[model samples]
Target: MEEVSLGTGNWDRLTGPVREMFVAHARTWLDEQSDPSWALLDLDRLSACTMPVLLSRGSTSPSWFSMVLERLAAALPRAQRKLFEGLGPIPHVTHPQQYTAVLTEFTRPAEAGEPAPGR
Candidate 1:
């Protein structure tokens, strides 16, 4: 985990305590990993939800993550996606104010007939 973190530029950006915490949590998750039951996820049932969904992703995340995000957006009825330019995998940790601003703006009620941001 340490080597991967350093290789991915996360070690340089993260504080010592934060890195340690992340490593500990990652180890725990790895230890807890098991075969996930794919049958539990009913995509047809999920697609029935009509509420607006906001899907945000950092620009520097793994390519596969972006593909998953695309798939999730397509599966949902009213999903809006926003790619945070120049941000790393965890944008809220790296750019808290910008992340908060985007979230706040997106959650605000839109004016009549006006499309929401990122729509």
Candidate 2:
């Protein structure tokens, strides 16, 4: 549990403003009722958002933002969604340990300042 909490905090810190974007995009998703599957995220915006700061040239396109947004639209509780954002994404987790490891990494035990137990 400590590991999860600390990991989440670390992810949040690393991602910067990504949480806000995820919330905004998610809220935008919730109020609108539509077929979730076909909902294509704005890939262009996502590309820009994931782009590194130094390499950045123009504003991130909505498509680029959609990459993460699309992953989040499971109607999951906001807390869970925020949790998901902190961890980013995993390409593959074949077993329980792997999955748990990913989730455990992001969520801190207490608040941001407190330290978590070592992994």
Candidate 3:
């Protein structure tokens, strides 16, 4: 199987255990790509979703991933986009505190009976 690591940013920053886990799961990750259903993006169905959507990505992620996010953000009615700077594809695993902060900030307004930012 091909070597698998985070798509961008500092892979070295990932803990050894985390890196090992990723390495061990590389085959499964690659196998997922072979499923045709994984490639589908039904924008019409997505546009019909009325719930709040938080679309996040690492600033250092591959450009194609950014493009996909941009497309989804445009299509989704209530999408709020966030960029986590200096991180890679799996920011939540690499920087849990930062990820939690972003998620909390996104949900705070809703929890307070206020409209989320994009709404």
Q: Write the per-residue lDDT of candidate 1 for residues 19-111, one digit (tens) a residue.
A: 778867986656544435422445677688787888887776766457667777878898888888766657666677888998898877688
Error of model 1, residue 74, in angstroms:
0.5
> Which residue pairs does candidate 3 place in steric collision?
none
How close is every model to the real structure, measured as TM-score? 0.71, 0.22, 0.75
lDDT of model 2 at residue 111? 73
Candidate 2 on 1-119: residue-level lDDT in tens?
11322232333343446555555676555545355655555544544442112111111223333444545443222213222332323212112354455456544454757454332
List the global CA lDDT of all models: 0.68, 0.36, 0.75
Off by over 4 Å in 2: 1-37, 40-93, 110-119
lDDT of 3 by residue, 1-119 (tens): 11233554456667889778877987887787677776568889899988788888876676656877887998899898889877666678778899899988887766658886656
lDDT score, candidate 1, position 54? 80
